[model samples]
Target: LFRWDGVRDVHIWLWETGIDFSSVIASFNCGTNTFAKNHLFRRLRWLGHRAASHLATLGYLAIWHGYHLGYFVLFLFEFGCVVAQEQLYALIDRTPGWAEFNAKPIVRPFVWLFGRLTINYAMGSTFMTMGLLKTKYWIGVSVRSINMFTILGCNSTIKSAFYVLT
Candidate 1:
């Protein structure tokens, strides 16, 4: 699971090596103007779109490649957790007395274990890389709103504050 230790590890690595190996959960959109400042990169961004679409199509064929893999893995993880909960309740035989809690020992910590495994590095990389590769798709008001919502959803108001403060 992505507990404090895992986050600490990432921070340590970043501090020691000036490297950021953040996956999707730790990544967010940088504004387009910042990206487009690079002249050659701006032109090449168009080429990236055509290439990404073709690749996305190929990926679509390959078990829809990375996306489906992550999706199904997550599905199984959640399903197994539900089954475990069912068994936990059955084993408990009855609810608690204090508040009559009709459940078993909560394994909430383990919840995010499979979550992290299914949310593997490759899948996250593909997601962000695809987003980056499709600049046109992630630009303008519609995309900007979506990108902003994504960050806000992640509860990362800190980065947005950085944007505003700077």
Candidate 2:
């Protein structure tokens, strides 16, 4: 079910972006060469999940044992990406965003962009969070996790840059 949901999310992403999956997959569309190069990010989001979770568990154990733990937060974020990707895919799939858009056709474009950017934030947030789950301390965490704590930092930066430029 999870795998299906993830694949469905990818399908929706492709569809919402106005791309045809069959043509791209069948080589009739080429997709600018191949799926690997063009879909690496989506594939990474799916494939790297297992490795990321394993890394998080190991890092958690190591930190729990009292160690250098510099990358613990990053490990956590990676794990979170794995989980969040699964969750957000499910959530967006089941959401009524489409219903709202259909009810207000004039705002369909805004809804489309909102959904797209929200989906991107979901991905980027998970990736950026990889920096926070660093090794732990009995009293307090090390400064290493600071870099990972603000997982949405990139989105904010992008928004601000766009606002400033616009």
Find the candidate with the highest TM-score and give its number. Answer: 2
For model 1, the stretches where C-alpha displacement exceeds 4 angstroms are: 1-67, 94-166
RMSD of each: 19.0, 15.5
Compared with the true structure, all predictions reach lDDT values of 0.36, 0.42
lDDT of 1 at 77: 27
TM-score of 2: 0.27
Task: State the lDDT of candidate 1 residue by residue for 52-103, as single tens digits.
Answer: 3323333333343345343333323223333333344455565445223322
lDDT of 2 by residue, 5-73 (tens): 334323444544632223222332243225333444334455355444344344544465345443454
